[model samples]
Target: MAGIGFELRKYLNDDSFTGTLKAYGFAGLISAGPWVLSIVGVMLIGIVALTQPVVGEADGSGVRQFTTSVTWLMGASLVLTGLLQLVFTRFVADRLYEMQDTIVNANLFGAMALTTAVSAAIGLILALTLFSQSFAYEFLMLANFVTLGNIWIVVIFVAGLKRFKLILYAFALGYGATIVLSILLLPFGLSGLLAGLLIGHALLLFLMVGVVLPEYPVTLTVRFDFLQRRLIFPSLIAIGFFYNLGIWIDKILFWLNPGTSEAMIGPLRTSLIYDLPIFLAYLSIIPGMAVFLLRIETDFAEAYDGFFEAVRGNATLQEIELLGNHMVSAVREGLFQIVRVQGATILILYLLGPTIIGWLGISEQYVHLYYINLVGVGAQVLMLAVLNVLFYLDKLRDALLLTSTMLLSNASLTWLTLQLGPQYYGYGFGLSMTLTAFLGIILLSREMDNIEFKTFMRSRPAQEVAA
Candidate 1:
C-alpha cells in the first residue's frame, strides 16, 4: 500500500504528467477569477435581494428566456472580442516577428489606444440608449463595467511582449485584486458588485498600460510600408465578426424569447435564469484562454525553429518525410493533451457537480448544461489546435478559409438547433460543432500535406533552428 501510494504521489507531482494541471490552474486563476466571484456575488446578493421564497415555475418557459438573454450578451461580447483579437493579434505577431521597434512603440500602442476608445464609446452609447431611462444607476454602472471590460482587451497585445513572465504576474495581481474587491463590495448589493467590477478593471487597465506601453513608444513618423501592412486588417475584422456571430446566435434567440418559470433546482425555481450554467462553462474558457496564451510564446519559439530547419537546406527525402511526420505528430499531441486535460476536468466536475452547484446556490438544471458546455469546449479546443497549426505553416489563406467555414457552420447549426427547442439547442450545437470540427480537421490535414510538399521543393535560404 505504501509503495502504491508513493507511486501515485509521484505520478501526480511529475511536471510532464501534470503540465496540463498546472497550465489549467494558471488559466483558471486569470480567466475565471472575476466571473466566479460575480457568480458568488449573485448568489449571496442577487438571490437574497429578490425577496421571494424559491419555488419551481409552472412551465419551462422562463428557462429559455433567461438562457437566450445571457447567451446573446455573451455571444455579442464574444464576437466583439474575437473581431478585435483577429485584427490585433495578426498585426502584433507580424511586427514582433520582424523585431520592429518603431512599429511596436508607435503603431501598436496607437492602435490599442484607438481601439479602446472606440469600444468604450460604443459600450457607453449602448448603456445610455438601452438602459438609461429605467435603471439609471444600474445602467450607468453597467456602462462603466463594460467600458472597463473593453479596455481589458488591450491586454491581449501583451502576447507579443518579450517579458511574458512579468506581464503574467501583473495580470495575476490585477485579477486577484478584482476578486477581492468584488467579494468585499458584494455586501452593498448588485450596485456594489458593479462598482467593484468597474474599479477592478480600471485598476487592471492602468497596471497593464504602466507595464507595457513605456516599453514600446510610438514613433511620430509613419512608415508607408507599415501602413500598407494593414492590408491584413480586413481578414482580422471578418474573422472576428463571423466568429462572434456563430457563437451568439443561439444566445440571442433565447434572450428574445423568455418563457414561463420552471424548476431550477429540486424545488427552487427562478424565472429565465441562464447565468449559472453559462458561467460554469465560462469557467472552462477562463482557464483555456490562459493556457492558450501562456503556450503561445513557447509554440512560436518551437514552431519557428522547426520551420526554419525544414526550409533551410535542400531537404533529403528522409528530411521531407521526417518533417511531414513531425507536423502530424505535433498536431496530434497538442490536441491530445488538451483533450486529456478537459476530460479530467469534466470527470472531476461530474463527480462533484451536484454538491458544488448546491454549495454555490446554483440551480440543478445547470448540471446538464455543464455537460453540454463541456462537449462544446472539447470541439472548440480541437478546432483551435488545428487552426493554430495551419497558421504556423503560413497557410494563412487556407486557415482563414477554414475559420470562415467553421464560423458559418457554427452559426447555421446553432440557429437551426434553437428552432428544434431550447433544452435541445445547447447540446445540439455542441454535437454539430463536433461534427463540423472533424470535417475541418480532415480538410486542414490535406492542405498541410500539400503545403509541406511545395515548401520542400522550393529552394529558399533556410533559417537555422536554435538548440
Candidate 2:
C-alpha cells in the first residue's frame, strides 16, 4: 500500500491544488477499486433486475436473494482468507528481504491451492445441505466461493507487488465482465448471475496470478515451507482474524437476531435495519483510505526509515531523538488528516442523506441509520491507521489486544442494542468502534513515546539479552 502511495505521489510533483487532488483521487480509486467495483457490479445487477417488466414483483425478491447470496459469499470468503493473508504477507516479506524469491512463488501457490481445496469442500457441503432444490444454484454458489477464495489469495500477492495501476485495470476488467455477463444472463435468474460472477472472478484470479508469477524464478515444485517454519507470528494471524471478525461481528449479530433479521436464502438472513446503511456508509471511506496510504507510506515510513538509518550510522543521541520526534509527528499528522478528511466526508454524506436515499429509492427512514454508520466506519478507518502504526512499531500484541477488544465489544454491544430495539440499531457498531479507537489512540501515543527504547531493547543480541 505504501508502494502504491509512493507511486501516487509522483502525480503531485507540481504540488498545485489540482495536482494534489488528482493524486489523492487516483490513489483512492486504486486503493478502493476492487471492492467498489464489486459493489457497483452487484448493484447494477439488482437495478437491471428491478427494471425488467417481464419479471414483475418476483424480480425484486430475486434480486434481493442474489445480492444476499453474493454478499454472504464475499463476507465468508474474506473471513477465511483473513486467517492466512497477514501471515502469508509476513512470510513473503521475510523471504523477499532475504532474496529467497524462488520459494515465494512456490509457497504462494501452495497457499492458494490449500485455500481452494478447503473452500471447495466447505462450499460443496453447504450447497448439498442448503440448496437441495436447485442443483444449478448449488453449483454456481460452490464455484463462486472457490473462485473468490482463490482470487483473494492471488490479490494479496498482487498487492505486495505494488502494481497499483495494473491491479486497478484487472479489477475493472473483471467487474466489467461481470456486469455485462450478468445482464446478458439475467433471464436465467440467480444461478446465471452467480455464474457471471464466478467467471469474472476466475478471470481476475488469472490476471492476478499472471502478474505475480513472473516475479519468481520458474519452479514447479509446491512448497508449504511457510507452514512448517516457525518464523510466522501467531499474533499476526490472531490480529488478522480478530480485526476482520470485529468488522463483521456487529452485522452478524444483526443478521442472526430474530427481531432485526429475516430469512433470505437457505438459513441465510439479512438485517434490513442495518445492512444497506452500513454498506453505503462504507463507500465514503475511499478518500480516507487514500490519505491513509499517502501519509503512512510516504511521511511516516520515510521518517521511520530515516530514524533507523541514523541509528545504524551511529548518529548522536540528539539526532536520533529528533528523528524519532519527526516519526511521531508524521504519524500524528497522518492520523489527524485521515480523521479530518473522513469526518468531512461523513458530514457531507449526512447532509445529503435524504437526497441519496431518495435517488436510490430507499426509504428516508434509513437516514438515521446511515448517519450513525458513517461515523462508525470513520472510526474504523482511524482504528486501522492506529493498528498500522502498531505494526510499524512491532507491537503485534498491542494490535491483537485492540482488535480483540473491538470484536468482543462489537458483538456484546450489538446484542445489547438489539434487545434495546430499533432506535438504538446503529449505535452498537458506532459506539464500539469509537471506544476501540480511543483506546488505540492512547496505546499508540504511549508506544510512540517509548519506541526508541523498545526498539533498542528488542534489537540487542541474544548473548546481551542473557545479561
Candidate 3:
C-alpha cells in the first residue's frame, strides 16, 4: 500500500503536467489495469486448463474439457478486444490529428459504448461456448467478472485524457479494491474470487461513468480527414498488430509448452510465481518516465531549438559546440537519475517480491524468472529512456528508425530463442532491446558531435571577422 501510494504521489507531483498526465493515464489503462487484469484472467485460464487430469493418469478427460473451454474463451475474448482496439484507435487518432477536441470527446464516448458492447458480447459468447455443464456456472461468472473490468479499462483510458490524476486515482482505487476483495474472498475459493472481480468492476464502471460524464463537455462532430491525410489508419493498424504480438508472444509460447502435468508450453509459467518478475518488470517503467520528463523539458528543449536553428541556417561553430555541451550535460544528468531510481526499485523488488508473491497466493515456481526478468527489464528501461531523450532532441525520424530496428531485432531474437527453447526466451528479448537502444544512443551521440562541430566552424568565421 505504501509503495503504491508513493508511486501515485510521484506521478501526481511531477513538474511536467502534460507529460505526467499522459503517462499516468496510459500507465493506468494499459499497464496497471488492463495488463494486470488480463494476466489474472489468463492465469485463471491456464490453471483451470492444467487442472484437467489425464483419464488413465487422473481426471484426464475433465482436464481436456476444461482446457478446451478456456482456450476457446481466450480466443474469443482476444479477437473481440482486438477488433474494438482497431476501431477505437482509428477513431481517436483521426480526431487527435485534426486537433478536433470536440470530436475527440465524442469519439471517446462512442469508443466507450463500442467497448461495453463488445466486452459484454464476448462475455456472453464465452459463457455459451466455453462453459461446460459442470463448470458452466463458474466459467460464466468468471467471464462476467473479466468482461466488466475490460469494459471499464477501455472506457476510462479513452475518457481519461486531461483528467490524468482522476484516471490514476480511479484505477488505483478500482484495482486496489479488486485486490483486497480477491484476497478477502479467497477462503471461499475460485468462485468467490470470480464473483469479487465482477462486483469490483461493476463498482468501478459505475464510478467512472459518473465521474467522466459530469466532467467532460463532449460534442458530436467527427472528421476522418486528418487521419486520411496521414494514412494513420494503416500506420496505427500495423503498430497495434505488432504491439499486441510483442506482448502476447511469450504467453502463447508458455501456453503451448507448460511441461509435464502442465498443458502450457512456455518457460515462464502463467502461474503466480511469474507474477513477481513480470510485475517488477512493469514497475521499472515508472522511473523511466520520470527521467524522460526531466530531460525533455530542460536540456532537450534547448538542444532541440539550437539544432533546428542550425538546420534552418548554418550555425556557427561556437553555437554548435554549446549545443553539444548542453546535450551531453542533459544526458549525463538524466542517466544518473534513471540509474539511481532504477537501482532502488530493483533492490526493493529483490527483497520484498517473494513475500508479496506469497501473500498473493502465488506459487514459488516463478521466483527466478521473475527476479532475473525484472533486472533485464530495468536495464531495458534505461536504454529506452536514453533513446526517448534523443528523439526529443529533434531526431524524430531517427528515433522512428531506431524503434523500427529494435522491433525487428526483437522479433528475430525472439524467434531464435524459441527455436532454442525456453532457456533463452526472455533473456534474448531483453538483451536485444537493450543492445539496440545502446547502439542507437551511440549513433546519436556521434551525430550530435558532428552537428556541434559543424555549427562551430560555420560561426567561427563570422566571429573572427567581427573581431
For lDDT, the strongest prediction is 2
Indicate the residue-level lDDT of 287 in model 3. 54
Report the Cα lDDT for residue 383, model 1. Answer: 67
Residue 32 in model 3: shift from native, Å? 7.0
lDDT of 2 by residue, 17-70 (tens): 988998889878877777788898888878887776432255377778888889
Whole-model lDDT, model 3:
0.52
Model 1's alpha-carbon lDDT is 0.54
TM-score ranking from best candidate downward: 2, 1, 3
How does each model score on TM-score? 0.72, 0.94, 0.59
lDDT of 1 by residue, 342-450 (tens): 6676677768778877886766765676677667766776666666666666555566666677666666775565576656646655765576568667866676565
Worst 10 residues of 1 by lDDT: 48-57
| Clash count in backbone of candidate 2 | 0
- Sorted on lDDT, best first, the list reads 2, 1, 3
Better of 1 and 2 by lDDT: 2
In candidate 3, what are the lDDT values of residues 1-467, reduced to their tens digit? 12333454476667688757754554445333444454454344334434433211254343233333344344434544553454354455444545554565555555555555666665666556744433634454555535653554355344424343454556556656665665555444444444555556666666666565453365655333323433333433443344344444444444454441243211112322332355457655665555544454344555666655664577675665676677677676767776777778778877887886677566665565666666666766666666656534434345545555555666677567657754554665666556665776676666566655443345433212210
Candidate 3 regions exceeding 4 Å error are 1-99, 116-162, 179-189, 205-216, 219-233, 260-276, 280-332, 343-368, 383-426, 439-467
Instruction: List RMSD in Å for every model shown.
Output: 7.7, 2.8, 9.8
